[model samples]
Target: MIEDPQGTILALFAAFCRVGGCFLVLPGFSSARIAMQVRLFLAVAISMAVLPIMWDTIYPKVSGPTSTYIGIIAIETVIGGVIGLITRYYVLGLQFAGTVLTMMIGFTGPPSQDILEDAAENQLTNLISLTGLTVLFMMDFHHVVMRALVDSYTAMPMGGTFSPQGALISLTDALSQTFTIMLSLASPFILYGLLFNVAVGLVNKLAPQLPIYFISLPFLITGGMFLLYFGISSLLEIFANGFVPVFEGR
Candidate 1:
């Protein structure tokens, strides 16, 4: 077998581009704070590590030295993106829960300083996103991402076609689950806000000029902080328990 060095280089380059592009958008791996050079190096390292294993199975099926290579690259990019998107969807759900709870506790709208995006945002959303990302890394939930990365090639191999309908359905399912979790986490704060609002309304009715509504803000904020402090452990535990089956496809 005459080893075509040009073909080998092209194949590696194509694989690198596809895989690297995917990681550029993947959560944990794709944070803006990381230097571009460092990320590129990491992506290159990943490609080097995995490509040899995949090339024998992947390269033979792919078309040779033409527009077909471009097509294959595009396909791989899509597959990698889908793998990253599924994980990101869940993280967004956790952030959404935090944002909702913050709003319920009267921390509504944008603030002057936002830690995550470097732009104005609801402080609570920013806090939640930061915390969630930190916790994700701390807990090594990134292993699921790595597993998904490996499984991606199995699920949608090189030169293998994508099932648009299946991908759409999967994305929709992930989003739905995210929304459900968000609501579940935020429910306590929502209930607190609702009950407190009603109570305040009743109290106002009994004494219109008592300044009860204005004075209640501090109490609401304080109560919300306490609830969050207490509920965080349970919320994270639920997230970990639920997360196991999600990537596992059980």
Candidate 2:
């Protein structure tokens, strides 16, 4: 039989606080589409699996006074939450880029249910977000998340003093880097939109009587769709490459 069952159990629970908090906002895993019960159980499973490895690091801080233990849990939760948010910001950047893409490409369809989230979104944006997330999953992004969480124990140990400034700095850097990468990925479309709109404007100026905008609507959308079809592979490829940079920023 295992000795000190109470200590072991407390350690497991402590580990859960961190892993659960992280996955709570994790991109695909945290989607509203995923049942809360599934998330809870998955978090518990991960905690149990990792607790043995993290026993030395986690068990000591968990054995203090009740108030101290509560504080430790709170601290660990924040650390985990911050780690998750870092990745979440990158995903949000992709969604934001997709939104911009839809507007630029003239795929401004009416709002529809987002397959990935509960919020309303353009269908094209939904398609792009879903595809990007799926590719990330296929690339084993969760493995990266789990590895990062494990390393976080060393970076921000349990019961350690939380630095609000450091957290803000890290969050700010993640956002900056994520959007930079996203803009790079979306640059081709942005340029296309610019050139296409400029041409449309010039044509409208040359023929004031013509309904240039209305005439160009179908062509604009059709051209953007064709560009999307051709460029999607490259767009997602560049995005997948950016995951390394995001983690490096962390």
Worst 10 residues of 1 by lDDT: 241-250
Tell me which residue pairs clash in candidate 1.
Answer: none
Model 2: weakest 10-residue lDDT segment is 241-250
Model 2, residue pairs in steric clash: none
lDDT of 1 at 151: 68
Candidate 1, 189: how far from true, in Å?
Answer: 1.0
Tens digits of lDDT, candidate 2, 9-80: 899989999999999889999999999999999999999988888889999898899999998888888888
Once fitted onto the true fold, the runs of candidate 1 whose alpha carbons sit more than 4 angstroms away are: 62-65, 109-113
lDDT of 1 by residue, 1-250 (tens): 6377766776677677667766867766777667779989988887777668778766675546577788888877877777677777787777778778887887665575655444566776777777777777777876777666666777677776778888788778888777877788889999999998898899899989999956888888889889988998887777756665564551
